[model samples]
Every structure is written in structure tokens, then in C-alpha cells.
Target: MLYNLYNEKKDNRKEKFWFRAIFYLFLLIFIGTVCWIFFFSSLLKINSVEVIFQETQTEYDLFNKDYLISLVKTAFQTESSGFYLDHISRANFFLFNVDHFSQLIEKKSLWISKVEIYKKFPQSIQIIIIPRDGAFILQGEEDFLVDGQGMVFAKKNDFLKESATLPILSFEMKRSVKINDQVLESKSAKFLTIISSIFSEQSGFELKPEFFTPSLISNELEAQVVIDNGWKIFFNTERDPVIQSKLVRKVLDEVIKEKISDLEYIDLRLPGKVIYKLKGQPINADDSDAQESKSESKEKKDDRN
Candidate 1:
């Protein structure tokens, strides 16, 4: 009777273990099904869409309403195959889609700030944009606006009929006009250094050049620096621009003291020599021949008299 009781007790324990296992299995399935119905299914089925932009410009409106919505819908369909409840993954996917959409739009001036996804019901997404702060023109032909990094983010339409009052960058025609990436990578560092040194010496004076064109005469790339005051300074690219600038300042101080403005060209290419041509004086080799001819004529007149 005792043996029979032991076997019965072992059997009861086995039954209890199986019962608990089945109960927990069913509970897990029920929870999973509830989650599938409430969150994933409902979230995946977008019902409404919202688009936001920092600025309400016509161009921004066109992109947010027309172009970006369609792109997001397509992206959502592709992403829904492997959707998750993790907030991090959702945020990352949204950012990725924003960047992709921005590239597809190809509007250089438009900057994307935030792309948000909301679960309304059937199928939709929300997108937001933040455009760059400053807008500048490029080469007087192309309209490119730059971000804080000096990157050319967007290019406006030529027919927009807008006048941009930014300083024109007059370097060689490069593949990109952005000053942030390409400039630092290329010859811009040296140029920037020169500009900085000039600024340090000339306190309280703004020396922004309207255009920078390459000079023909000197080994250094001479820039025809046009200031807002209608005075043009011929700056050399090779020499330390700081030293050259000091020399220029000295010459200008003297010239201003003498009250001279009828100057043709000021050559800052050479060291210790600030050669300037008067308004009517010839600056080339031909001037010597003219001077000799005039002297000869004057001698003949004296002999004849």
C-alpha cells in the first residue's frame, strides 16, 4: 500500500508539471496575439499623414506635400516587412528615410531637420524639415545656399528672379562650390590664413572682397580684390598676404595723406616695392619708347629755334 501511494504521488507531480507548462504556453500565445493586434498591426496601418517645415516657403511646401509623402509611403512599405517596437530602431529608420528622401528631392537649398512617423490607423507618415539659415549666390550664375559648415546645401532655380546679396567666390570652376568640405581639403586653408592675418592687423575695418580673380603677371595667383568702397587692391596669392597687406596700408596712408586717388594700378607682388602708376601713365615697356620720342622732338624744336 505504501509503494502504491509513492507511485501515485510521483504521477500526480508529473501531471502538475505538464498542467503548469500548458497554462504558461497558452498565456504567452494570448499575450503575443494581443500585442500583434493592438500595437504592431495598428501601428503598421497608417491612417493619416502630417508634414512640417521650419519655413513656409513655396519650395518647402512643394517638397513636404508632394515629393516627401510619396517617398515615405514607399519606404514604409519596404520597412513594414521587418518592423519592431524598439524606439531606437524606429528613430534610426526615420532618419535614414529623411536623408534618402532629401537626396531624391535634389533641391540643394532645402535642408531636412526631422522626419517623424505617427500611428493614426490605415497608412501614413509625418515629415519635418529645417532649412539652412544663410542663402548665398554662386559665381553670379548659379544660386547656391550654404549651411553653417559652409556647405552648399541647395541650388535655387535660375528663373526664380531673386537677387542674392552674398559675397561671390571667384576661384577656378571646381566640381563643388561648397566652402566647407572642398575648400578645407584643397587650397582654402592657406587663403583663409592670409585673410585672417589681414584682419588682425586692420582692426575695425571690414575687408570683404567682392570677387577674387587670378592675376596674370605674377607667379603667385594675384587676386583682384574689389572692396565695397569702389577701390580695387591687387593681392598676390604666393607671398605672405599679411606682409603685403601692411605694405599696402602704408602706401595707402601716404597716398591718402598726399590726397591722391587718381592711381591706375598698385603692384603688391614684389617685396619692399609698392609701384603705382598714375591714372594716365603707361605701365608697360611701350612707355619708355614714347618718352624717348617726346625728348627727341623737344631737342629738334630747340635746335630749330
Candidate 2:
């Protein structure tokens, strides 16, 4: 019986030792995997990057591909911590977050309107950028760059060495504006875009866009465009811009054909009607009607005589 008890105790000791050994093996493996992913794995690291602009070759110079890639690499290198075990501490494949990286690019570049980042598995990334159209420049206490979306992106702190050919907007604001503010109203911006498209569509017209002045009429905002040759064209704030542009083009064609001179302003506030005043004549529909009646009366008197 004593020998049997001693054998049973030995078997029990061996079983406990084996269990502990297996448990420690699994623990070691888990730790090693964690370390490899967090510190040494290259699976999620960005090995290659591609930059694509939605513009033509001439526009590519505005955004440099090498500069963008350098910015992205800098972002990846500075990541401190993340949610999953795949934290991108040192370019680990599983640790890189594309969304966060794209945001970093956007925060650095102000003129970019949209950014799309695509990861092509194991090691490559593609970035697509859409930049804002430098439609107009707002000149006030300082000059600001305004796009077609009416967003003022950067100041005239000498970022762009060459001046853009876009019109200068003279905004009448009650308060000062900051960068990224809607300095030029959306309606005005849209009007200018539509007008430009219309002018382009017409074959024989050579319209040169210039400055715009914002005004308030009857509690509604309106804008005026000063074109080449001292012509002032007005726009209604709430009307259809397409129709208004067509009317302006028609009027211009007529004026050119008739060789009209001493023009003052073309007002297009009323629907289906154009009201214009000459340099020294303040004639309107009422005045025209009154003058026609007097002329008719004089003709009748002469016939009676």
C-alpha cells in the first residue's frame, strides 16, 4: 500500500508540470505576436504611394506628388497610440489607418476641397485630390483667395507669386472675416460661375470678367458685375441664374448690333423684363407711355389743322 501511494503522488506531480508548460507556451506565443505587430511587422506599412489629381497636366504643378507623399510619411511616423493591437508605431502593416492619414493631409493643405485615399493591400496607397477653383479674390483689409464654393482659403501673404486672372470681389460686410469664412456669398459665386459658362458658350463674345460689388435691395442681397469697357450688369439675388445669364447675353447682342453708346447700367431685377437707363436719360415704362400719348395728340391736332 505504501508503494502504491508513492506512485500515485508521482503521477499527480507530472500532470501539473505538463499543464503549466503548455499554458506558458501559449502565453509566450501571444506576447511575441503582439510585439511583432506593434513594433516590427511590415504588413500594414506603406511601401509605395501614388498621387492622382483630377486636373490636367498643367494643373498638376499646383499640387506636388512628392510633397504629398512626404507629408503622409511624416504622419505615419508620428503616430503615438491607437485602439487595436495593430497600432502603427513603426510602419506596421496592420497598424496604419488610412482615414486618419488622409485627415492629416487635409489639415496641412487648406486649398484642397476633397481627398480620397485607397489602400491596395500589403503595401501600396493611392491618393486622389480635388482642389478648389480659384474663382475670385476678396480684397479688404487684406486679400483672400475665394473659390467657386465661396470658401476663403488662404490670405494674400504672398503664397501665390503670380496673380490669378479671376475677378476681384468687393464684399460689403458689416464685420470682418477670417480665413475659411464665406466672405463672398454663395449666390454671388454661383451667379459668376453661370455667367462665365454662358460667356464661354457664346462664340463671338469676348467678355472679360472684372470686379463685383454686393448690395442689398428690399432686404434681399444682389450683386453687380463690372465687365470690360465700363459695362455694369446687375443680377437678382433670388432669380434663376441660368435665365438671367441668357437675358444678359441677348441684351448684349442687341446692344452690339445697334452700336448703342453712352450706356449707363443694365438692370435685370424684374422677371421677363429688362430695365436700362441711358447716361443722361432716366426714361422708364411710364415716361415712354406718356411721351407716346403726347406725340399722338400732336399728330391729331396737325391733321385737324
Candidate 3:
């Protein structure tokens, strides 16, 4: 009986030994897999990067390969160094957070409007870029490039200097504005920006005003625009610009069709009305002589009668 008990105990020891061995092997594999997934994995490394610009733009050099690679590397390094003790907080093919990368790109540039990152599993990354739409040039103490949102992105460059097609705005400010600052925050500037968008849509009737002037008249805001012709058209700041523009266009078109070149001023301050002035003709001495002759003839006819 004791021999049988010893044999049973030996069998139990063998079973325990095998169980421990298998458990230890699985533990080692788990640790190794975690390490491989977090680091030193060929499937998770960034092998190739592709840049795709959404539209044709020559303004900024944000799509250079070297520049984008460096930007990505910097973003990943920051993610890896964060204090969160968790599983694989990094930027890689499989583990890269697209939203985080987008946010990083946005923070890096003030002119970039949209950024999209696409990952082709285990190797390549595609980045799509969309820049802000440029509206017009604002000429003040210093010239600036303004966007549709009235945001001043950069200083005026010579590339678009021949943009006579775009309207020029002249504003006077007592304070200075920094780069990427929004200087066109006033109501008049906003109205002008909205009008520019409208002009862009209307291809049939192009309203490319040469200049915009905003001022205060009788403690009320007023805006004036010089159209293609030399005439100065006035607008009331309190009125809706859309309605005012429509009225001005209708009156101007009529005047233009009539071939009237004596236009001096156009006032669109009144609701649903347009007030205009024309250059008056001066009377000459010839007109007086003709009138005197006609009067003498009429007097002689009356005496005969």
C-alpha cells in the first residue's frame, strides 16, 4: 500500500511540473507579443508616407516630403512620451491615432483648414491637405492676406500682387495686428467679406469694386464702394447689404443701358429706394441771345394781332 501511495505522489508531482512548464511558456509568449505590438514590430512601423493636396495651390510649402515626415515624427514622439501608463500610446501604422494627428497638424498651421490622414494597413500613410480660401487683400498700415472668415493669414506676397480682379480694402487702425491675427472684425469688414462671396458666385454680373471705404456719418456707420466706373456708390451700414447690393445693381444696370455718363453719386440709404445725382449742364450766352430774339418776335406778332 505504501508503495502505491508513493507512486501516486510521484504521478501528482509530474503533473504539477508539466502544468507549471506550460504555464511559464504561455506567460513568456504573452510578454513577447505585448512587446512586439508596442515596439520593434515591422507591421506597425511607418514605412512610406504619401502627401495628397486637395486643390492646386502655390501659396504655402506645407506638402514637402521631408517637412511632413519630420512633423509626423515629432507628433509620435510626443505621444510616446506622455505620462499615461497604458498599452502602446504612440503613432504607428496600426496604432496611430488619426484624430490626434489631425489635431497636431491644425495646431501647427493657422492657414490649414482641413487635414485627413489615411493608413494603408502595415505600411503606408496618406495625408490630404486643404487650405483656407483666400478672399481679398486688406491694405492698411501693412498689407495682409485676408480669408473668407476675415482672418489675416499672412503678409501680402508678390505672387498675388497682380490680383487687380480682387477688391482692395483700405482701413485705418490705431493699434497693430500680429501675424495670423484677424484684423477685419468690424461690421463693415464682415459685410464686405460676405459681399465678396456673393460676387464670387455671380459670374454673369461681376461686381469687382475697386475699393471699399468705411466711415461714420452723423454717428451712423456708412460704407462706400467705387465701382469699375469712377462713380462712388454709397451704402447704409444699418441696412441689409444683400438688399442694398441688389438695388444698386438694378439702378446701375438701368443707367448703364441708357448710356448715361453724367452719374455723380448713388445713395442706397433709404429702404427700397435709390437716390442718384447727375452732372448739371451750365447755361451759355448763346442761349440768352436766342431767348431774346424769340421774345421780340412774339411781341411783334402780338401787336399785329
Candidate 4:
């Protein structure tokens, strides 16, 4: 009995030793994990921030390394420490609120492509931006620069002072052409192409429309073109646009040859017939007089009977 009791005590002591060993091992592991999380994990640390821009303009001060560092510090102090790890950060938060950013950029007259954010670690955030490429100016009430896709880009400070001799688009902003949507109608596209070609071909020919009016004949898809010479040219989209353009060129050549400065209107809707209204001709007046005379003769004959 004494021997059995001693063996049982020895086993109990061994078990206790193993339990203590396991407890100490677990404590060490937990401490190591905490240390790694606090010191070694990148989630808790930021090192350096890189700010990149699309065109690297002098206007974007945030693109500067020093400016970006200061911004990151400011954001860290104002925002939560885990802001970088969060779904949205100060750098990319602008993207989610695109309308706000767009408005801000417009208000500041600055163009932007994209704003990107990257976490370097202990306290650094990288902000990258891609700016829009300003293409042409849309001449209207609020004249603004338009990109290739007809998207209105933000204006720069020098944009107002310095005139960029880009091609002008005579497009009436209708409900069909939404603010953020692209107007890709074949007629409009073709007209723009023709205007571009004209500008490319002749340096003297600048695009200046007398008035941009829409017509309901083609579901308001057609726009009347009036040049500086008071020559009204009807532009139809259903017909072959290239052919119509050629006809217009022919008529212009003829007008120059004939020395015809005054023309009422030129109708190019028909294929072969070019109905042109001549200057100094009483249109509809003669017809009205003839109808009146015929009615008077009919009344006299009725009186005689």
C-alpha cells in the first residue's frame, strides 16, 4: 500500500509539471503574438508614403513628398489610427464621394483622373492621382473644356487667361445628352469629324455657328447649320452624311463662283434635287395674289349668272 501511494504521488507530480509547462508555453506564445502585433505587424506601422499624379502638374501641391507627408500626418491625427486598414481611407475616401470631389475640383478649376491610396506602414499613406487630359473648349453659357469622350474637365487658372485655340463644338445640350453621359450619335460624331477635318484642311475656316437650332423632322436629331454668310444649310442625319457634306462643299464652291452672297436656304434632303431659295424673290406672295385673283373672277362669273 505504501509503494502504490508513492507511485500515485509520483504520477500526480509529473502531471502537475506538464500542466505548468503547458501554461507557461501558452503564456509565452501569447506574449510573442502581442509583441508581433504591436511592433512587427504592418497593420500598426507606417514607414513612407508615395504620391503619384497622372500629369504631375505644378498646381497639385499634394503631389509633393513633403506635402503628402504632412497630409498623412494630419489625416492620422484627425482620423482613427486604423483608418488605413479600414475599407476606406482618407486618400481613397474621395473616390467614394465622386460627386463631392468632382464639385471640389470644378470649384478649384483642377482636373483629376483618379486618386489612389497605398499603406506603407507605422504611419505613412501614399496618395496617387491621375488627372484628366483637357482636349477642347465647349463654347456656351458656361464654357468649359471637354475631354475626348465629351466629358467636361475642370479648368485651370491659366485656362481663362490663355486661350487654347481648340476646335469648338456647336452642340445644344439637350436632355438626351446627359451631363455625365456620352453623346455618340452618328450625326453628331460625323459632324464633329467633319469639323475636325475642315480645321485640319483649312486654317482659315474656323467653326462659328450663327445659331444651333434643332428640328423635329428627324425626331429633333437634325440640326440646322447657318454659316457666317447667312447661308442656311439643312443637315439631315438619315441620309448619307458623307454625301451630304460633299453636296454642301459643292454648293459652297458654287456660291463662291456665282458670287452669291445672299441665299435664303439650301435643302439637301432630296437625293438629286437641291432646292435653293434665291435672294430678292417673293416667296408665297405671288401664290397668294393668284389665289385672290382667281377667287375674284369666280365671284364675278357667279354674279353674271
Candidate 5:
């Protein structure tokens, strides 16, 4: 009877062990089903995308909508590492990488300057595109439209109306530029623009805008504005362009005063003075008989005296 009781206890332990094993197996299957429903299922996949563009100054045709849509769609379908395998669909809303997509768009599209992305819950995406606009025209071996940030975006032939109206800046030699390249420094471009507007308004003649930025040397870092009357004016780029402009206006009104034909060059690079050279005399000539009207900076005056 004691032996029979021991056997009964052993059999009871075996039954409990089987029951625990079955319960654990069912729990694992239930957890796996939940993971499949949330991750590998079709309910959370992205099915649609909407693209909105910021209004740009250039023609709408410059930014192609179909190309942009294709790029976004391609980004959405990119493959990701799976939980069980190497390939999985990135179309799922939770798996989509927004930062990577934005960078991809900006990198590939030259017309696009900025991009914003939004994910609509349950199955859609929205993106906004901001395009680059022409700020000035740089004429060289080829002409290009440059934005305020100094990036070249399009060719001149592409925008005829804009090319006609905007200020034209040229180098002495041809500039090798392609789309999406920075052709000018922002500071230099702004200085040239200010000088152009001021000269056009005051002198009543458009400048042959050739900016010489060859070196750090003072002589090479000058703005040469050739007037219609066959004379020139030189401005120091390192100096304040506003003050130089004021001095130019003052000399035009008070000193030169319609004597532009006799003028060789008005050198405003000098501070507190306006130096004018005439056609007959050489530049930096001693003002003895007054063929060249002289305005000298303190250093120059000290040299002459």
C-alpha cells in the first residue's frame, strides 16, 4: 500500500509538468500572432502620398511634380531589415524614415532648396517643397541664375523675362559653373547689388559691372564701373560700400557736377576725400596746374606735402 501511494505521487507530478508546458506553448503563439498583426500586416502600410510646393518666383515648370512624386514613392518602398529575414517593406508608417527622405529629396533635386515632411496617421504622407529663386544673373562663358544664398540653379535661356530685368554681373574671364554650385559669396553679391542700384539711380547710366576679386591685395579687390561717357570709377570693396556711395553722390553733385567727360576715374577708396583724374594727365599725378582735380586721404596728403 505504501509503494502504491509513492507511484501515485510520481504520476501527479508528471501530469502537472505536461500542463505547464502546454500553457507556455499557447502563450508564445498568442504573442507571435500579435506581433504579426501589428508589424507584418497590411493595415498600417502607407498607401498614398500628397506633395505641396511653396510658391516660387520662377516658373512652376522649373520644379517637376511627377519627378518629385516618383522620388518620394521610391523612398517609401525602400527595403528594411526584417525581424525574421533580411528583407521587409518600409511602407509601414512606423518604419518610414522621415529625415532620410528629406535629405534624399534635397540632394537629388537641384530646384528644391528646403523640404518639410509630415506623416498622417493610419496610411498617408504629406511633403512640402520650397524651390530656389533667381536673385541675380551671372554672365560668363555661360549665363546662370543665382539665388540670394549664392547657389546657381538654372540657365539664363530658361528664364528670358527674368534675365532681361535682373542685374547682370560678369567676371573679366568666363566662370565655370553648373547647376547647384555656389558661384558667389553672399557678401560679395550683396555689395555688388548695392553698388549697382546706387550707381544706376545717381549717375543715370548702367555700369559695366566687372568686379575684380583676384587677390587679397588692395588693388585687385576693387569695383570698376565703366560709365557710358568713356570714363571709370573705382571703389574699395573692403571699405563701407554705403559711405563710398555717399561720397560718389556728393562728388557727382558738388565736385564733378556734369564734368563726367573730363573724368578719368573717381577714386573713393580714400577716406574723407574724393580723388578725380582727368583724360590728359596720368593717375596719381601731382596737382600742380590742376588738369586733375585732387581729393586725397590723410596718408596721401601727407605724402604729397
Candidate 6:
């Protein structure tokens, strides 16, 4: 009876040992397979890159596709911590840093407001480029597209067909302003948008952009809405456009009675009055927005001198 009990115990020990050994071998094989797939195999490495411009149509065909693709390739090879890549030709799909790649590409152009990246799995990467939209077009001899952030990102030729409908901010350019320039500050850009919509709503006609000059006004702090050759309206770009627009409505309804034929210009920058000039008249005075006007006039004079 003792010998039979010993044999039974021995058989159970052998079964447990074999089970553990087989389990370990399978576990090792699984681990090795995973390592090969993730780290060593070309299957998970980046091989193909595709870039899409969010707004650009496929028919347009990218103007600088090769350059853009080069930019993307450079961005992909780059390391997360540094601007340049280490000697690696391609990154593993799981290891590509999307955030870092986006930042690197966005810095390459002011026109690029955002960049989105997606791993198309196994061996491909997809990139989407979102170009900035214009809040207003700064109409110089060369029209420049201005964004809500007051940045000039692209020229008229570079912008799409919708440029015609956008409100204009015509500048009598004494000096050339180029791409990536902050032609208007953030507040002024917001200010222009408000007043442009107001003018469009009130006039019942599409008006040209408010005119600006380096010497006089409309660079940033002030804007002039020109009617004809010498006809215009002056605005304090700093004030609330809603209140100013309402005051303009009041002046038209009560004072001028909407008779603009003889009107030369209306100045809405004054403290208490809406000052205007007619064809043959002297300047309808305020305090003539004295402090504000005089200071701006002085700056213009200073620029002139």
C-alpha cells in the first residue's frame, strides 16, 4: 500500500512539471513574435506618407507638392525631443510622435494654422494641413490676406476665389508690407470685422473697404470709409463699433436725413456730436474729437516730416 501511494504522488509531480514547461515555452514564443512585429519587422515601420490640405480641392493640384512632401518627410524623421532626427531612416508606427511632428511642420509656415496627423496603421502616415482663413483682405497694390489674428499669411494670387466677397481694408501704402506681417493688431482686426458688417447692413449697398494711410490714419487705430473722390466717413477704431454704428444711424435719420448727395464726410470720433462736412462747407467741428484727432494728426505730421 505504501509503494502504490508513492507512485501516485510521483506521477502527479511529473504532470505539473510538464505543464509548466510547455506553458513557459508558449509564452516565450508569443513574446518573441510580438517583439519581432513591433521592433524588428519592416511591417510596422513608416514607409508611405500622404499629405492633404484641408480646404484645397484635388483638382487644384498642389503648387509646391514636392516641397511640401519634403517638409512632411523631414517632420516624420525628426525626433520628439529634438528638431532633427537621429540616423534612423524611418520610425516605427507606434513610436512616431504626433504632437512633436505637428509642431515642427506648423512652424514652417504662417499660413498653416494647424496640422493633424494620423497613423494609417502598419506602414503609412497621413497628414492634414489646415491653412488660416482671412478675416479681412488688406488691399494694397498687391492684395494681402489677413487673418483674425491680424496676420498677413498669403497674397491675393495665393488666396482662393472667395477673396472678392471679403471686406477690404485699402491702404495707401507708403511702405511695402509683406507676408507674415502683423498688418493689424488683434483688437483692430476684431474692430474692422464689426464695423465692416455694420456698414454693409446699414448702407443697403456693398461699400468698399475703409481706407487707411501711413501718414493720416487707418494703419491700426483709425479707419476712414471713403464714399467717392473726396467723400468719406471717419471712425474711432478703438471705440465700440456697435455704439458708433448706432450713433451713425441716428445722425443719418435725425441730422442728415439720409441725404448723402451733398455730404462730403461724417466724423464719428467726437465726444458728443457726429461731425460732418458737405461739398462747399467748412469742417463741422466738435471738440472735433480734438484730443484724439489732433494726436493722430500730429502722428501723421510726424511721419510726414
- Choose the strongest candidate by TM-score: 6
Q: Write candidate 4's Cα lDDT for 87-141 as tens digits.
A: 3343332222334433443444334555665555445655665555444445555
- Model 5, position 197, has a per-residue lDDT of 67
Better of 1 and 6 by TM-score: 6
Candidate 1's residue-wise lDDT over 1-305, tens digit each?
Answer: 99999999999999999999999999999999866655555444444446555553333222223444455456545544444546323323232354555454434324443444343333555655444443333453455544434455455442223443344444454444442332221233344324533644752234553445442112343334334333445555544555556555665675533534555556655444566665666552112223333554576689799
Clashes of 6: 0
- Tell me how candidate 3 scores on lDDT: 0.57
**Candidate 2 ranges beyond 4 A from true positions:** 1-44, 56-77, 80-90, 104-110, 156-164, 172-175, 200-204, 215-230, 252-256, 270-272, 278-305
Q: Give the runs in model 3 whose Cα sits over 4 Å from its true position.
A: 1-5, 52-91, 94-100, 114-120, 158-166, 172-175, 194-205, 214-230, 252-259, 269-273, 280-305
- TM-score of decoy 4: 0.39
What lDDT does the true structure give each of the candidates?
A: 0.47, 0.59, 0.57, 0.47, 0.64, 0.66
For candidate 1, the 10 contiguous residues with the lowest summed lDDT are 284-293
The per-prediction tally of clashing pairs is 11, 4, 0, 7, 0, 0
- Candidate 4's displacement at residue 13, Å, is 24
Candidate 2 lDDT over residue span 130-235, tens digit each: 6666666677878787777677887755343353355555646535767888755676666655565464464224345554454311213234433345555566
What is the C-alpha lDDT profile of model 3 across 1-305, one tens digit per residue? 99999999999999999999999999999999978775656567766667665643444332343444455556545654533246443545666677877887777765567888888877677878665555667777776666766687756652333433445666433456556776554465556646644533431244444455542112122333334554555555444555555555656575444644666666665544466766684311112223333554576689799
**Candidate 5 TM-score versus the reference:** 0.55
Q: In model 2, how large is the Cα lDDT of residue 127?
A: 74
True lDDT of residue 250, candidate 2: 63
Off by over 4 Å in 6: 1-26, 45-91, 118-129, 139-143, 159-164, 176-179, 202-205, 215-231, 285-305
Enumerate residue pairs that collide in model 5: none
